[model samples]
Target: MKKVLSIGLVRGVLGQILGTAAGIGLMTAIRTAMGLGWKAEPAAVLGAFFGVFGFLIAVGVVTDWWKWAKGEETSEAEDFQETPGTRRYFGVSLDHKVIGIQYIVTSLILMAFGGSFALAFRTELASSGMQFLTFQLFNTLVGMHGMVLIISILLGIAGMANYLVPLLVGARDMAFPRLNAFGFWIAVPGSLVLLSAILVGGFDTGWTGYPPLSLRAPLGMQMFFVGVFFNGWSSILGALNLIATILRKRAKGMGMFRMPIFVWGVLATSIIAMTATQLIGLSFQLVLFERLLGMPFFDANNGGNPILFQHLFWFYSHPAVYVFVLPGLGIISELLPVFVRKPLFGYKWVAMSSLGIALTGFLVWGHHMFTAGIEDYLRVPFMYSTLLVAVPTGVKFFSWIATLWQGRIRFPVPMLFVLGGIVVFLLGGLTGPPNGTVSTDLHLHDTYFVVGHFHDTMFGGYIFPLFAAIYYWYPKVTGRKLNETLGKLHFYLMTPAFLAMTLGQMRIGMLGMRRRIADYDPAQGFGPTQMVITIAGFLVTLSVLFLFINLIRSARRGEAAVGNIWESRSPEWAILPSPAPAHNYERDFQVVGDPYDYGLADSQFVELLPQPSSDD
Candidate 1:
């Protein structure tokens, strides 16, 4: 019992519960003193703050800093020397690899919740009228689905960045190890706060949570605001840590241009996350304050412009799309050459495209607001900027195809997923230009067509690539490879289903089907299409279930895969043994050649330290 209580996760949960009660009690006391009624929104908001703080404290994320502040001596060990067991994962281990796995587990949990929400709404949409779910509940499910999946995506990328960046860069740990742990641990309380919204009357403003409507949303709306607001801290700080690590912690001879392609992707993503995340947090807080304090930040009648909220929200939200996908795209770039047995085609251009995408991502947020009553003059420029993203994005596609030209390509599970990403993302890219044009967007905006395009982008840019990464790296993390048959099954089932679902959505969307509605008209002739989409949605879920089964069953039972499982040229695989050591690299390495010198004989990406002779 004591051992369990000592676990950071358990302690953090208990602390959050007590802190929540205390926050509510404090709010009640303050209201009583002021002769005002106790409010759920204000109390919940305070409770959220306290809950997160309490969790951080209980997890001991700041213990070393606190000790320093008290003028006490502290151990300088970078490795936490965590005991070898599952219990270490529950506690705050400063090891980057352990933190990475923690992020992956947390992401999967969130994905399960978010995907369940999606299935619920998808079932409701199968037939026009609502089935077993109230309109408000359905609305909440849809909104929750979006936000939860987004948080899951962020965590997924963070997991990839955290685990891969250090080893790839030849660093022992992150530049700020405690900060890395803190950034990850914070997501737990943040997700809990977000999920608590459903119990608090639910927010129906969609993930964007634009104001006016948001100002008048239920008490649960505050939970949603507080959830994403806190999650933003994770993103911002994680990005900061990654940028610092990559810039300062590279192996000897590793330069900015010589880093792995995925590292560049992370670099671009971190830049966006660090700079743009604050806007979303700021926007959500404004709405929270408006609701709790009766401030009119977006209340037009009270002299606040509602459109101002959109500007602030999308400024981060659109770039946030890049934050979610750049790493996946980087994964795609990183893995393509390995399997294709070719040097990454146009390496400099591919590296620069990530930054180009990040920069162009910022100027294109206004495209989402083209019909949101923004200035007429602004729409044209926004359209152009939105269209400009395709250029650098196109460079990536061409380069990938070129890299695969007549090469000895291997179709492993990871490669299958990489290929899947290309096809789906290509669909997403092709469909985007139509929306970039104002006339076409006027027809397609707020319709299932837009939803289809967005899903294509997400699946292609993140989900598929994420699966590829997990499969490719599972061996390194677990010292056992996932079942090839199960992985192939996962891909085949999911790919066809997702493609059909999204394509069906686009087809019906052009026929006038709107988005986010719980029910639709039977006369619209969309029943068959909706049924197909719903069925496909369930199939995708089943496919993911297969993946879960594969992961669990294969962890102990799968083929042992120690030592350069993929025979790749990346630093981590070339040097580290399976299940990578706590501190990655027992000795420092030097970058001696190109990151993806796949076909070059006698070429090495990094030079490992010399081992001492047994005679000595």
Candidate 2:
């Protein structure tokens, strides 16, 4: 373990160095291409620097990723082989736990940065733009905000979870931990490339990276394309690792049905990631190469339909939503049983429901393009599929309610967040069917209504649940409990802010407001709606202060957490207080009951039927 750590540190450092150099090379090429009189623009120069630096750091970690991947051999099965200490972890380690932390930390950084950009927008929109930022800068901020948030979700949930899932489920490590790390590290270059666009040329196509407009933009579009493609690759590889691990790795008695809801959620997500995430990778890469190399894959003037790219883009990108949101659903599912004080009701149903959503999620990408000018018949099939997703989603909702029905519910901060998640997710889910139909989507398409609906679900599904997971499990990762009072305050302020902010958008959408325009037409008179959203946005910003305060304070002086804080049922809670050890359980743990059989006798817990031994 010590040896692996040293090697990991070395590799990590090296990857960062290489990545930085590569990014600078790309920047140099772009500058030359634009014929900028031997001097690069300041923003482009800065973007290239950070993008290259960030990519190098991400790629560095990929070097040690092999120890994490699966085959006949595993790091653990090798049983304490001497690993050389180097700077590899500074580059990459195959350790799922380390990679997971990398993803999580990266996501948080993006969140803070993105949120700041959003706050900038809110302030600007509050009284109309006061010339605080140029039109180009404002557009760049909006586009970058979208790109960063998407990266946060993909990296934080998918990258981090890929590393952690094997440990959480009580396997030695992920079935393909090395590949898992590789996927995650690949995202670095992509992020840097996208960032380069902002620093170097500033594309306003938004994170969706729409073509034509993107094609017409400066070198920024190409950079956005490159970054998105790399990020997509990371997701695909991470998904494949999770699927293989869940399918093959398990302690003696854990069965498919016996797998934790978190695993089920990830399992479903993996399928989506493996199958659907790839198309976007291909499309984005092709788009970048085409734009740079004059291939013109989506240029209609060259006999290519731009909308065809939209279809291909949506083919992966839509399911990518499930990839993003489903893991969040898994996080909620993992927490509710503990907070609600009951075994998850309809475990099979809830688990299967995640899979159902992932599958159905793919068929509904057309809903995004309703305004992109596709056929009329295409709309209804897309509509039906979009609406059908709600059914599986509904079943999961019912299962949560069932789990909570008449239980000894604890309203701890984590619990409060989980409840909030359900409320918001349901609100978002309910809105889908209406918009799924051709008539309704036509009305709300690209409106703030769609924007509001997604935030409710996405934030509800991801953010609240993320905090819940953080509160519920951060102790396991970092041996400290965030201040309780501050946490509660955080929840209180955030929940209302999320509601007000999201719901306000719906109101504006209903009043016939569109999205992505920097200024609203005076005829629309968006002053009041904009004000409400802006205020709600500030409230949400205020709530973030509590978290920042609490985390910083707790890290400095918070009481060390107990081994079994919250009395969690999962293996994660089984670790000791403060700095979880390598090889968490010294001995193979013998399970005697259902994971959440808190009040019931361990004997009363139904034993899931065992699986055939790996040896068999």
Candidate 3:
């Protein structure tokens, strides 16, 4: 009992409960003393706010910073040595690798919840006539499904960046170790608050949470707002740490252009995450204030324009898609050469294309607002800018194809996911132009077509590549490879099932089916397609189950991986051993050649310096 209680996660949850009670009691007392009636909404909001800080404090993520505030000198070395074994993961530790695993584990947990929510709703949508769920419940599921998966994706990105960036750049740890741990820990309480919305009265405004609707929503809406607001800090701070690390901590001879391709992807992603995340948080906060304080920022009848809300929300929301996918795309670029046995064709172009996609992502947010009655003059420029994103995106495709041309390609499970990501993302890309075009968007807006396209992009852009990264690097993390037979089964089942689901959604959407509805007209003959989609959704879920099973069973019993399992030239695989050490690269090394020079026999990516003898 004592051992279990000592776990930081256990203590943090206890802290949150106590803090919430205190906040609610304090708010009630203050309201009663002031001759005002107690309000559940305000009290819940305050409780949630205090609960987050309490979790942080009890988890001990803030201890080092608190000590600094007292002008006390703390030993960084002692902090690392204090925690050992798996307990380090439960408690706070400054190791980037541990934090990265923590992030990934948390992401998987959230994904499970989000995916389960989706499956429940998909089942309800199968035949149509008000099956098993209330209308409000269905709407809540739809909205939560989107938002929770989105947070999961963001956490997954941070996980990959935290674990891989420092190693890729030859740094021992992040530029700000405490900041990295803090950034990750905060997301835990934020996710809890977000999930707690369902226990309270759930909101139905969809994940966008556009105003007027949100202002009138139940107290759950405020929970959504508070949750997202806190998660935004994680993105912002993690981005700052990543950018600083990339800029300041590269191995000697590693120039901006010579760094690993994945680092460039992270660098571009961090830029957007650092700057644009504030807009979404600000938009959500404004709505929260309007609900509590009766501010008229988005109240249309009270001299406030609701369209202003759309502008601020999408400014961050749309670019956030790139933030979700760029790291995955970089994973694609980084791994493709290794499997194909060729140099990354047009490496510099691929690296710059990541930046191009991020920069262009900013100008295209207006496209989402085209149907929202923005000024007529704004639509044309937004449409053009949205279409312009394809140029950089196309460059990546061209490079991928050219690199695969006449190369010795292997069909490992990781490579299969890479290929799957390309095809799915291409379908997403092909479907995007019509939505961006003003004439077609008038018909497509708010339809299941948009839903289909979005699923394609997200699955292609993040999910597939994420699986690939795990499959490829699982050995590096655990010194054991995942079961190949199970991985192949996962890919084979998920890819075709997902394709069916998205394609079915598009078909129904083209036939005038709308999004976010609990039921459809049976007279419209949409039942069969909906059934197929639901089945496909279940199949995808089953495939993921296979992956989880593989991960657990193989962690202890799988074949041991010794050295250079993929035979790649990258520093992490080539110079470092399997299951990277606490501090990476015990000896210093310098970059000596191109990162993706795969086919060349004499090319080398890095050279390790000789160690001095004891006599010296």
Candidate 4:
């Protein structure tokens, strides 16, 4: 881990410093000695390359001459030992459980950061102008928040599924554990690059990074490109790892059909992430070249069409929706069985719907650009594909409602979040059919209607379930109980506020209010909905404050929890400790019956943990 960091950090820093001197010296010597004028940019880039080479030489010398001699890698290893207060989590820990926990922690931190940006944007809106920040700053905040949350949402699913799915399917670790670590580490630096946009300048393209507009922005746009590029790499790696794991690592009895619906959703999501992420990465890299090296990919003056960037970008990004939402659907599938006290209805159908969503997701990217004036003939196929998505989505919705009806229901935080997601996602889906229609989208193309619909699907999909999943699995992760009263308080405050904020957005959109516009005349009808959304935004912000407090108060000082607090049906929950040890499952436990047999079999129980050794 230290080697990786040293290689990246020292090499970059030295390359910049020495490269600057080398270029300046060369340029001065050329003009002075030869009396010949030439361009400076090429020399500067070459110099930076030379400086980077020098750093590599230093690295080789240090490693071969000293660090590698007398077993320094082993002896000097203690130097890299984590200090008590240092960021210990940045190291490589290939344990699926550790990586899973890391993903959750990372996304949570980024979520807070993203939510803070949302608050700032809301504050600016509340003042109806420059009260908290300037116009550029507001735009930057909104854009960064959107990007951060999008990245966070994508990774958070992989993380939760990583921790839960293997155990749910009775597997030991991922199919490729080392690659899993690499997948997660990629996101760490990617997030840093994204956040750096705020310091350098700011990207106003939002996460969408629409071209022509993106090309016209400041150098900060380059930072956005770098960050997003790295994030795409992470997604690709995770998707590949997950697909491989699901295919090869299932328990003895669990086959593709027998696997839990949650795992199936992850499998579908992995496929989408694997195949779709590359287009976005390549598209963004093309934009980066155009910005940094004056490439002609999107340059209209150079005969390159900027619209091509949009086509390639949304080709991957539109499916990126399923990348985010499908995992939440998986979570809901997992939760329904536990809380509603019933086997998931139409398990086969629900599982297939996940794959259905993924396969069809690729065909719908054109829907995003209905207003961009693509070929007239192209619109109909894209519109049809876009509407085709609704069928699979609707199937999952019906399955959930069917599961909940006439069952022994428990209204816990997890169930609440799942139910909330179902309701809100339905509302979001209602707007989608409109967007699919060429005529309707022409009017609502860039309006707040788009904003409202996404928040409904995204927040309900990611944020709401995130809290629910956290609470559901808290005991297993931390070996402690979260304060129930505080958890309920957190839930009540958050859900209503989110509805207020997102629902209010729907009204603004219907009233023909445009998105990304700073302000308008106070006399217009936009004022009421604008004020309502702003006020609701603050309410949601306050709700987050309560959640943070609950997490902080619970993780450390909360009472130690017992294993299987819910008497969970799965084998992973049958451990002796609250949070299971490094390798879960005792030797005494062997496959006997299905996990959801409930109280049907007296012989279903197995001897707990610390399985017999070879000697025994």
lDDT of 4 at 344: 75
- Provide the TM-score for each candidate, comma-separated: 0.98, 0.87, 0.99, 0.86
Model 4 backbone overlap count: 1
Question: Candidate 2 clash total?
Answer: 45
Candidate 2: tens digits of C-alpha lDDT, residues 149-232: 878887878754754577566776778755766776666556656666677667777667778887777677666766776677
Q: What order do you get sorting by lDDT, best first?
A: 3, 1, 4, 2
lDDT of 1 by residue, 485-504 (tens): 99999999999999999999
Q: Pick the candidate with the highest lDDT.
A: 3
Give lDDT tens digits, candidate 4, residues 311-407: 8988888888888888788888877777877767777888999999999988888877888878999999989989999899888888888878888
Point out the higher-scoring one by TM-score: 1 or 2.
1
Candidate 2 residue spans exceeding 4 A from truth: 1-91, 575-578, 590-592, 604-616
Kindly indicate the candidate among 2 and 3 with the higher lDDT.
Answer: 3
**Whole-model Cα lDDT of every candidate shown, in order:** 0.92, 0.73, 0.93, 0.74
Candidate 3 Cα outliers beyond 4 Å, as residue runs? 77-79, 612-616
Question: Pick by TM-score: which candidate is best?
Answer: 3
* Candidate 1 Cα errors over 4 Å, as ranges: 77-79, 611-616
Off by over 4 Å in 4: 1-90, 586-616
Candidate 4 Cα deviation (angstroms), residue 333: 1.0
